[model samples]
Target: GFPGNYTDHTIANAAALLGAGRVVGVHRKAELPNYKVFDEKRYFHPGSRPTVVTVKGFRVGVLICEDIWVPEPVRSARAAGAELLVVINASPYECGKQREREAIARARVTDVGLPMAYVNTVSGQDELVFDGNSFAMDATGEVCMRAPPFVEGLYRVDFVRERGRVVPRSGPVAAELSDEASVYGALVLGVRDYVTKHGFPGVVMGLSGGIDSALTLAIAVDALGPERVHAVMMPSRYTSQMSLDDAADEARQLGVKYSVLSIEDVHRDPRDAGRGVRGAPGGYHGREHPVALPDAAADGLVQQDRTDAADHRQQERDGGRLATLYGDMAGGFAPIKDCSKLLVYRLAAYRNGLGAVIPQRVIDRAPSAELRADQKDSDALPPYEVLDPILAAFIEEDLSVEEIAARGFDRATVGRVLDLVKRNEYKRRQAPPGVRVSRRAFGRDWRYPITNGYRRESR
Candidate 1:
């Protein structure tokens, strides 16, 4: 019992959720993925149970995520007098997986001459985002009801009615949604549930007028509503008037409360703190490693003093690192804290172009952290179009430096980008968990040691 049966625990949990006489059935995952950062094979036993249970006088068969990927579960469910199939899954979010699941599950119903009701969980548990795209199909092989993707709802579908198999008569579900739409759905649902369940009424974001913040703000407004949503433009001197103006505009349009809190004061406070009663700057430095800055200066990159940099880094310097209380200050959670720079831009554009669209001023503004004077995102990061691809290769595909070089990226640029990503692992670790649309995410799917001594060929 030291290791414990996760399968048994899972089954029991389902039973509790459905309650007594509800005929809750738990199907364990028969196949496990255990390579390149996955180790499920080391944990639980392969599922052998595939029987149907009668719930409320309706015969139901339940299967886990991976079980029905093959044909055995469907065949067994039909063989067990199951007229309606209910699948409880914990499938991860890969690019086009929600649509694929719908196709695969619908086919199973048609192939077996039974109805299927699929239920999925959502949220970023480490690396994977379980998009709850629950759906149902009748015995005639027609999809009757589909719960929206990237959300969680306990709505009922008439699997069979009047003992005559009266199917659900809901409106047509949205089909052929864009990939971004699917990704956005997952993020919004995850945000909604996480905030609501955690007892947090709503969320707030530091809207920088960049795609990431815009998307995050939009998603937060969507999930928690404009009333609960809050936006803060923590602009520094380098933050363009364009960005600040656009950010403030989004808050107004959404009807969310907007605040302008300049981080310049905190940046200035730190330098004074270092010289005054706050003790020496080195006093904040204990167990600290110089990972934030590069040794060599190239491409106009220079070590802009960390005194006004990250409060977390400052805490680290003080031998006591702490995350900046941005969320706490605004009294709301951050929705897309872990979203990549490039995806942020694209998502911003997508939101702005939708329905009424975000104003052109927001999209046209340059990206900046607004930490100092004349600071541009290009000063801290490479062009997103260029940077995102390499990040996708390295983070999503797990490609190495040489492999990326073979893809026609400049070797020096690749090394620099890779280094920036690696060095910022600590920051990424501190970031709020975002939606995991890609195969490999910032946290779960991709993990490398932070204190590595290995150098790339360019070095």
Candidate 2:
């Protein structure tokens, strides 16, 4: 059958590396570990046989990544008189996959008396990282070569049997990197691939000069190059001189376009609009009605009205101000919209980097939303050290107030914390979408009411 006309027909180009030949075999992805990370079943039909290859010299057969983890794939390939086995893969990296693969491949090769070439793709997608450590072995079951770890590389081996030397000639090993190095590498790789794959012109975001923005700027610069990154410092009246300064420093360090546009005026305009927001009848604020209150009726009657004040204030509240309202608009993308204060700082520390790019001052300061006069995040929420863990418990762990209190937190504090969380549902609902890094994120795992009579669980 013609390649394009085959539906549910799987075929491998057995002759891609060989002469003109074809191996028409139906093989589907074997594993669908659809947990938090993988989605293979949704995309592929399970490969029927592990190693069915098109007739080619060397009796070569193929196995997918997970298929070779078991015996059937290798057994079938060997039964077919395959002298050399090639396993193409999108194997996810867990701890020590190389060592595990060595053991698994050794078992497969020894049982079959066949040389195996393990070719794993190298890159990051989602939480999974593909460390391209593609390797090979000899028919005598000796490892011919080991590819470098966590990289993109092509390793070719000259299999010599007539000469009787299975010795491997190797290429450069991309040096082993630290866990931080590995994670950082993964983020950069994922960012680059995603942006390029999605056909984005480039990325634009706030360069808050704090850790999160600093790290983000560094990442963006690394991912798309400095020329492609546009960084803005959309400061409010409360934006400390340090914040403004540090954001500038980050943009400089990352070599991206940087600018500051104060949102103080923007902030004030919104606080002023709190009048409309408050009095708008039924918007977010306003008087609660029974079946019908005049105020409630008035609130729902929002016309196709556009207030420069309203747009400006909504922009400040909804994050459009950082671009549209504030005009420090970097480009068309935003990264750290609702990230907690702690991560923001940690990211800054990360940006300090292998070199001292981010300033220590950014790391050592208290975090603030800086949207109002004399403001700090602590003004509205508890300090992150105190607030973050509690948020983790209440939001992520789903611990009741009593359980949270039991963890050495004051009962009063716990009660207040829960109240704040419930109260802030409106803000969280209105806030810009933030990248999720927690076991649970506010946007998805939670659905609560803005108007309710239910008090604390204890009550």
The digit string of per-residue lDDT tens for model 1 on 42-123 reads: 7666666565776777777766665567777788878877767777776777668866887787678778877777777756
Best by lDDT: 1
Candidate 2: minimum summed lDDT over ten consecutive residues — where? 306-315
Tens digit per residue, CA lDDT, model 2, 93-177: 5434466777888888878777788888876553345767778866555677767765686677654444532233443333445
308: Cα error in model 2, Å? 25
Clashes of each: 7, 12
Q: State TM-scores per candidate.
A: 0.71, 0.62
Off by over 4 Å in 1: 1-29, 32-44, 53-60, 71-85, 92-94, 103-116, 121-129, 137-145, 151-173, 272-334, 354-357, 453-459
Say what the RMSD of model 2 is. Answer: 9.4
The per-residue C-alpha lDDT of model 2 at residue 88 equals: 75
Clashes of 1: 7
* CA lDDT scores, all candidates in order: 0.57, 0.54
